[model samples]
Target: MSILLIILTIILPPLAVFLQHGLGKDFLINVLLTALGWLPGVIHAFYVNKR
Candidate 1:
């Protein structure tokens, strides 16, 4: 992943997911994960970005 993705994923996981995959299930999941906890969001963002 790029530096920007890493930074975004860390700072705003939902935003990072949205950037990579747009508005969809992954984005929604990321938003939910983010609401649940920062770490889960970050992990999900990274996982989504990696794919």
Candidate 2:
């Protein structure tokens, strides 16, 4: 993951993952995680983006 992506993920988790992976399972998961809690979404976004 790029620095910008990491920064974006911190600010907006779902948007960061969506920009990287688009509308897919990872994106959906991030969205749900984001809805549930900010920290989970950030963690999931980092993991997903790295993968």
The numbered model that scores best in TM-score is 1
Worst 10 residues of 1 by lDDT: 1-10
Q: If scored against the real structure, what TM-score would every candidate get?
A: 0.95, 0.91
Q: lDDT by residue for model 2 over 1-51, one digit each (tens)? A: 678888999999999988988999999999999999999999998898888
What are the lDDT scores of the predictions, listed in order?
0.92, 0.90
* lDDT for position 19 in model 1: 88
Error of 2 at 41 (Å): 0.3
Q: Worst ten-residue run, lDDT, model 2?
A: 1-10
What CA root-mean-square deviation does each model show from the true structure?
Answer: 0.6, 0.8
Q: Pairs clashing in candidate 1?
A: none
